[model samples]
Target: MNDMKELRILADACFSAQVGQALKRFNASHPEIQAVVSIAGAKDCLQQLKTGDVYDLAILADSGVAAAMMPDHTDGYYVFAGNSMVLAYAPGKILNAKNWREKLSDPKVSISHLEPNAHSVGYAALMACMLADSVAPGMSCTLLNHPGRKVVAADAEVTDYAFAYRTECIAKKISYASLPDTMDLSNPAFNAHYSTAKHDLTGDGKNIVQASAISHAVTIPLAAKEPEAARDFIEIFLEHNFTAQGFQPRSEIVGKSPRRIHAALEVRKPPRVQSANYEDEADVHLLQRARLLHRQQPAAEAG
Candidate 1:
């Protein structure tokens, strides 16, 4: 554990840059630990974890998908952070509508979302639309298909609107419409309501992904070459502030509890930020409960 090591990570594309930045800082502080991050679609990351021993850790935004894919790959995963879905439009667009739902219902307006089959954010956007339709009829608008968030952001000027993460809009300086709590898949408190909306991953009506609050999960694979380094990186990651980056800390959702106490350390100055054990039994249970609607293959088929 003392020897210099390299910790490889596969991360969800939507927030991969932020993760890479966090790990880069970790590497700067600890020269002995070299962090390598590779970005890919959430499903691709899981598929790689399933097939090879290349990555020490995998971080994905969709906890349900990760849990469904991580049966025998690792011990378990920790929910580290969460993000909200937002409607990003070009800067000069005039908005006289009451809310995002109203603006979306217009057939004249064109929109874009990541290809539903290739990315979790795409499916999330689809589910968001379905939920919006249920509450307010006639939210039926055609969505332009894009391969990734960057493409969607790039085409935002030409396309009337695009569904993207709040973080993406903030980082790219695109104007976005903040959704209501009922429609924004950000708060864990609205998990039940969100579950009512779902998207079929496979066109055959099987393998469906239900709408749930967006929370990111990180896990150290059993095949990790540097498990200790991966754990250290995760510890540093959770303590770092991502609020400016548009991520809501897991501590605010379910990580903090009265029964938990800060580690006993004799020092005049307290730690800059108290770290939360994201793998705590109660916190894991709560996260699992929130993701009741998930796509899981049968054991016989999964193997």
Candidate 2:
């Protein structure tokens, strides 16, 4: 590999800015390697990869990775970062956090969400809404009619609220309410609860089941033009970039023959549960309602 070669990365839009910033710093320090990043929705990014669009590295949500894995497009992959869904809003627009559920239920307050199938955040948003509705029946219905839009656009507007990533809200300096672990889909302890809510994609009738947590997975594709550079970037990224940007970094490496390891590494399976005992009576009720709802209607019709 040449010392001055450039590396191309295709990443999900949610964290691309932060990733670009990290790569800029890496480029400055290393001088020999320059990296450029392209950001898009998770679905779009994965589709590009599937169609033989060349990139040295790819970063996307776990769901997207799952899709990529099916086609053997990934040489290796690992969970690098974790994030949770939140309700982002402009300052002073909604008062009284205690009445958030009521506010969301009120038809007077307009809400925005992302397309459920196109993006992980969108799918998580639907799960969050369904979780909210389970706590108080009919809460999800209020958001059902709300049109889906990009999170960036939603953040810029002064709408009542929009479903978004907590890290994104923080990075963009937007006011947001952190949802509970059970609803946010960011805690492994709530896997049982999270799995209860599900929604179907718009085009395909495939149901998007909620995972225990929202994670960012990075992979080096088999046909990468600069595999060595991709490995170097991953090493620098996992060691320094992710934690600085408010992501919970994983210490383990995954997939067959992971790239350079700066420290002792282990290949661990995705977390199925967390030790935290955060579930309360309300959580129990929420899960109960979710299971009941799932049984009551088909996923396609429910969506």
Top lDDT hit: 2
**Which number leads on TM-score?**
2
**lDDT computed for candidate 1:** 0.64
Please count the clashing residue pairs in each candidate, in the order shown: 0, 0
User: Deviation in angstroms for 95 in model 2?
Assistant: 5.4
How much is the lDDT of residue 65 in candidate 2? 54
- 1-303 per-residue lDDT for model 1 (tens digits): 466677898888876667867887889987876898888775576567777757887777787656655457765666766777777776566432244555655667777777776688878887776665333445433222222223343333457778777777767776676555555688787787799887776566645678889988777777888777777777666655566566766632122111122233121321122112111233433433344323222543678
Instruction: Point out where model 1 deviates above 4 Å.
Output: 1-5, 96-99, 140-157, 202-207, 252-303
Model 1: pairs clashing at backbone N, Cα or C within 3 Å: none
State the weakest 10-residue window (summed lDDT) of model 2. 271-280
Model 2 stretches astray by more than 4 angstroms: 1-5, 29-33, 95-97, 145-156, 199-202, 206-210, 241-245, 249-253, 262-303
For residue 269, model 2's alpha carbon misses the true position, in angstroms, by 20
Worst 10 residues of 1 by lDDT: 270-279
